[model samples]
Target: MRNFNKNALNGKRAIITGGGGLLGPHHAIALVEAGASVTLVDINEKGLKRAKTKILKVNDSAKIATQILDITNLNAVEKFEALQTKHDTNFDILINNAAVNPKMSEIGGQNSGRIEDYNLNQWNNEINVGLTGAFICSRVFGSRMAEKNKGVIINISSDLAVRAPDQRVYSPSESFDDIKSYKPLGYSVVKTALIGMTRYLAEYWGHKNVRVNALLPGGVFNKQPEELVRNVSKRTLLGRWANLNEYEDAIVFLASDSSAYMTGQSLIMDGGRSVV
Candidate 1:
């Protein structure tokens, strides 16, 4: 049996964007467990509080901080710098996990509509939050990492980054023709762009020892409608949606020294969905 040291990230300082989302808190818990001080940033104040609460529940002694900021704004650069100073961390790791992703329950039922009906404002907003926001965070935070010659960036992408969304998964039946609504094009486009940026930065910063990589995670089970869950589960080789804890180790590995030799890569944890 191989003995893996879970505390491989001792004394590390990490930052996670979109730390208020469904999987964001889980990412924080994983990094905290690995012995890293975490700063969770998000635009949603309530969500940020909830996420921090969850993390505290898991590890009472965990060194955690919460910040509310919009990553796409130019002001984020200053705020990020201030966060590093306030936390007194040189920023050993950055998880670019923020994005405008709507849940299955939010689709059709919420303000979301079909692609043909997707508002121009909505499109630009998603791009700004998902792609441009990532670039802003990377530019401000990653530049410091490059200068220090040490850091890791884990860009959280989706299975759609590689393959187009199976529109059938959103329909009541597995029929594409009868689709009443569809996953917005902006979501897939932004995620794919992140992968490209990941590769570009990996090479751009390789000489500086600032490793960059992307994690393509599949749909996580988050109390969505049963039919939608079943639809996606059948499409996946794993036969079920991913539990929140499933990707913890992968996130930790990418953030820690475990992936020291790896960069410019997309680690797909979609339960073989991309192959099919």
Candidate 2:
């Protein structure tokens, strides 16, 4: 039996895309706690500042860096990669976590919840940020990892990747016709596509000792409306949504040698929502 060291990532470096979002800082904190230096990449400069502040508040000595870059632009990403190389910073882990998720509050009116009314621009934007961005980052960062013959790539998918969104949860009232919001088609499509990407990359980089996988996390409770929370809770076996930091340990496990033998797999961390 091999002994698992909690500090297995002591000197490892990681790069997390979408590092300015709600969960991005949490993921960075987890890695830093496990002894890894982290660089967070996102287009939202303000959000990146907030994420860094949040992480530093937890651990003043945490090794965290933030960069504002559009992941959809291949040239931009390549430039960022060149800069990191110039600094002699080779990332040992890459977390494809950046995405544009449309909330219920952001939907309705011209942005109708109905599929037929979905705007083309919205679809393209979401797909570009959530899907294309992931591809570009993997191409730039993962390829470098392959050159070194060791790395891990984790695609942050959603539980919706495995199961379709239960549209009822978006309904403001008990009546089905009262659905004021929806989980956009692009959201699910992007997440589902990530699964396929994970499989392909895992195999493509396996010989190079680069392991790739996806983390399909369920909804996190973030001050959503009471009714929405109730509806989502009813569908989940755990009877509630996940807390903000719930996925941190899983992120650390995937990024570290703890999951050494795991590859090309989707690790679903929904509150048993998919099962029920």
Candidate 3:
């Protein structure tokens, strides 16, 4: 990670979806520190406000911008290309970080479920963000990056893909981490789909010099219930949820030249949760 310096992201531009949420602001903070001009996008005005305020506090001269956008807005996403041209600006990095999780999932946190019971509408919503959001953003920002012949993308992911089977409360043969994380069956399925999408983009864009990757994060502990956390931590080697700041360096590295040659891969940082 030390191979990357403060100016590694200098003069670069980034757009982080879900910028008002837990991981969004941290991404903004680290990018600004690394010298990237960032645009934080979210559907919530309050979140956007808080994110911008926090970013400016870190660097008075930070080149940070905020946009109120719902990633699933098909018309807006479709027109993004023309919009960028009209504004005389283009994005350099696209972070697909926005999502609507278990609140819509059918499992409703029951800690168990059958895939057949999945909610179709909820599944669509999750897939819309995980896949379509990334697709549209990639097309928009990626076009500009392709023009410049260089760019990077980082999709926020989860460790559920390879999380330890032994740690699950239910039978190992009957994994239900998704049911545990949020309600509904599609949560895990969508995340797994994201990994596949990342690989496809990396392969398709390699010759164009644009890299796409995913970061499978551990349970982020802020506002988490102690009991809930302890239960989750046992599966992880670290035996604890991640502090918000813990994600900063890894994200910065992926956004910078430090991991230029690395693409189309999932970087799992679940405190060894997958190994237990």
Candidate 4:
């Protein structure tokens, strides 16, 4: 039997969308540490800088690049792809990890949590960033990968993609009248849509050696309110939220040849939350 190569992605290149968000940098870190050159694309310049800083701290020699662009804009994405091709920097992996996750605490108003009162603009904005952005990036990057007859696309979905959010966790009291916070409907809808896209792309590019998959992660602990933490912990089988770095290895696995046979699948690493 041939031994597996530890540096499986030594010369591989990757592009990560929403590269400046909470999990984006960590995803970059995982790919960087695994020997892949990573380009992080995001609209927020500061977040991109911060993500680069965090990755540099982990490995100063890490091959990391950042770009400011809106993934929802197809023309912008196409232009970026053209520029990358000009520089001979074709990507071997694409991680569609961008999304807008609205916090209940940050939103305010009498009916903020009510679906009937959800702002149309907010709904459009969230879907544009979360679902549409994924579609755009996959089209721009995955197409090139298909032409080359090799690549991987990992959509960063959520555990909620498989299961509906238990809105009761966001409420302060058991009474329905006292409930003032509920998870946004767009979040679940967008995440679920990603799964469908993953399947479609997987088959579309399967003959060309391009593999597509989705990563369904659970909530990460980021200093949430005590009550909220407690409520979520009680429901999770692991009795706690995942650590920020917990998904790093999984990201590397999906990116590298280690998962060569895996395609058109959803890798749920939610501490068994979806099962329970």
Question: Which prediction has the highest TM-score against the true structure?
Answer: 2
lDDT tens digits by residue: candidate 3, 1-276: 223478888888888999988789888888888889898988899999998888788788988888888777767865755687688677778888887654222333433334555556667887888778877787777767877888898988788655432323332233554334333455676677789888988998889999999998877777655545656676668878788878888888888888988999999988887765
| Candidate number that wins on TM-score, 1 or 2 | 2
Model 3, TM vs. native: 0.86
Off by over 4 Å in 3: 1-4, 103-118, 164-183
Among all windows of ten consecutive residues in candidate 2, which has the lowest summed lDDT?
A: 1-10
lDDT score at residue 100, model 1, on the 0-100 scale: 85
RMSD of each candidate?
2.1, 2.4, 3.9, 2.7
lDDT of 1 by residue, 1-276 (tens): 112366888999888999998889999999888899998989999999999999999999999999898898968666768667676676889899999887756666435557656888879998999999889888888998998899899999999999989888777877977666678899999999999999999999999999999999998888888888999888889899889888898988898788889999999999888889
> Global lDDT of each model?
0.87, 0.90, 0.76, 0.89
> TM-score of every model?
0.95, 0.97, 0.86, 0.96
- The candidate that wins on lDDT is 2
Off by over 4 Å in 4: 1-6
- Give the CA lDDT, 0 to 100, for residue 176 in model 4: 58
Q: Tell me the lDDT of candidate 3.
A: 0.76
Q: Which regions in candidate 1 have their CA more than 4 angstroms from the true location?
A: 1-4, 82-88, 109-112
Give the number of colliding residue pairs in candidate 2.
Answer: 0
Give one digit per residue, the lDDT tens place, for model 4 in 1-276: 112244768999999999998999998888888788999999999999999999999889999999999999999999999998999889999999989887666766753757878878878988999999999999999999999999999999999899989888877774456667778888899999999999999999999999999999999998888888888898889999999999988888888888999999999988888897
